[model samples]
Target: MGFKKDFILLTKPYYCVNILLSLSYLLAKKAPGICVYLFTPKESECELDGRETEILFFLAIVVMIRTRKTGSVTMINYLTSSFIYTKIANLILWAYADYLYGVIFGVVFIITALVIPEPTYSGPEHVTYFRTEHALDDELESDKRIVWIIAFYTVWNPACVNFAPIFSELSAEYNLKNFRFGKVDVGRFPATGKKYHVSDSSLSRQLPTIILFKNGKEFLRRPCVDVKGKLQTFFFSKDNIKAAFILNTLYKESKENGITTDEKKQK
Candidate 1:
């Protein structure tokens, strides 16, 4: 599945090049005499002798190629494809100057051959954090194997910064097939914060909110506060969190599923 996504991303430049080439061909067909004449200096005696048309076509092609290459490279990097593959693919595509429907069909065939659904993370130690709201939503909606414990945080908050390492340590200690940990930066995804009712104010009280979800619905949250709405900062510690949540719920679920911490340690 990763390979398929990389393949599609890698060939995007070629797709863009094909579309641009087709558009240019259509435009040239519309004014064949002017376009062909521009390429041939000897045909300068033609009525449409203006060099502006030729220069515009040249500039358009250059801009199209440059923009497509930039976009493709950016996407490949974002998806974290192999550096060697990226270099080789970019070199080949950069050398390619012509486009054809047959070549486009070939690309489509290759993509279809490689395409597969993304696999779930099966590791027991590390948590898989999400960068976008869409991805987080999709994962929650589609996967029901695990109870998701998502930390909604912002980088600018000192409390959140302090809690990051603690969260990582907890994830390493308590990770199981039935319980998983994730995090989203509210600063990067304000919509996600809003959807979860965490970051409504500029100085959000719940800057480092932690929510537990099962079967796509939220069941619990952290930073238990008082009637005056002041956060209980002391309860955010690793040992406290484990006693309150992990031991009571996640541990029970893992045991019911026949997975023990002893088994994890042995692995």
Candidate 2:
């Protein structure tokens, strides 16, 4: 249920905006006279004799601004708000034009509202990492069967941004019941950085540290320091990570525990 709600929240804004734009364009093209009557603020205020197209364009902009301000982008909110606005505009048009035109406009609004589909929701399929230190510690301690691979990253670091897609792909490919992948934004949670010895300062050199934990203990890590104690940033690639950690450490552990490749393939 939580996943369903998240998916709806993430996707509804785009869908609603698209539907509003398309409907506005269709109305403008098909019913220019009606638009000029409905959208023009006051018939006596200005002369819209030769500016029908301009009025329609500005009308679309007005609808868009109202939708944005509402901030609730669900289909129901958009349709209800749009219907009320359209009804008010049509009332104004009716005072100037025939009552039949107002009825037509109301019918059009109702049909369009009914035709708009509610946005669909789908949850993410892969494992995700928590952000805070306590969450990470609790997960590690409570689940002895889960081996965690955590990437400690800072938002300002361009290297971390570049490596994000690679990390995500690896997570989808290699995640298992006993092995999982996640990341922490050290920029957001500085205490998490300090706990893992990840420097959050902009001037500090070390960033994007990847750590492995098994049985609630630190197992291995990337970007080891040099002889002078200066941190080294290793090139983060899928093949490098797979070879260094997945095949070498994780696969070995899985094999020892009788979690064979054939069983994983069947799952």
Candidate 3:
């Protein structure tokens, strides 16, 4: 009952005067000798705690306007509030404010999750780390199983950026909590380049390379040279590139074994 009345008053700002008048009358009736604070006159006329009252009054106005404009309370409202409070608390070192801000931030994030879209991905998450000395050694030593995909590219290549997003999407999709992804900037990670026999010199032209690994061993590697023609022909076609990945990683063994019984059956 109390909540409903406050909500109603929130919408009809004019009702605030009547509500305040009723509150003052009740307080006067309960304590006849005590002075009562009645809501009257413009905010400039208020004598006690005028600043606090003004802030509250302004907040109420903002709420009224936003509610009318949006037609519903939105998660963005809470998120914006939380962000503001957090920034204030962090800069001001206000522990109480920080605590409240943290709570609001968490609550707002939950609300946002109900409406915001989750990001999607396009390919295998882990890529090779080819440019570090003992990169493979470190992976082999780690207790966890790791998947690696290494993209080989030259500094002069203009086509790499066009393919970067699709590759990132794939990585996002496949990047499991336990699994990891790494990039071997062949130009930067010289040892990685040497380990993979990739050359930075113009003569070698090692751009658009992918190497996959599991348990520190190189399971699959797609050298830029191997698919030079195909990559150039369908570099921007996600489906084509994705199919190529399937061919290299998933169907490598079948192709090595020659025409399988499944293919014979299909034929």
For each candidate, C-alpha RMSD in Å?
Answer: 15.4, 13.4, 18.3
Evaluated with TM-score, which candidate comes out highest? 2
Model 2 scores a C-alpha lDDT of: 0.61
Q: Could you give candidate 1's per-residue lDDT for residues 120-238 as a string of tens digits?
A: 22334467879877878988876565688888888766456546656787788777776788999888988988888888355566767888887788887876567997765433556
Put down candidate 3 lDDT per residue, 186-235, tens digits, no spaces.
Answer: 66666677777666665443444566666567776554444445322123
* Stretches > 4 Å off in candidate 1: 1-125, 200-202, 224-234, 258-267
Q: Which stretches of candidate 3 lie over 4 Å from their true place?
A: 1-132, 154-156, 224-237, 247-267
Among the numbered candidates, top lDDT falls to 2
lDDT of each: 0.58, 0.61, 0.45
**How well does candidate 2 score on lDDT at residue 234?**
63
Residue-wise C-alpha lDDT for candidate 2, range 130-229, written one tens digit per residue: 7666787778787666688888888666456545656777777666767788788888888988898888787655567888888888888877777998
Residue 17 of model 3, lDDT score: 31
Task: Give the C-alpha miss distance for residue 20 in model 2, angstroms.
Answer: 32
- Which scores greater on lDDT, model 1 or model 2? 2
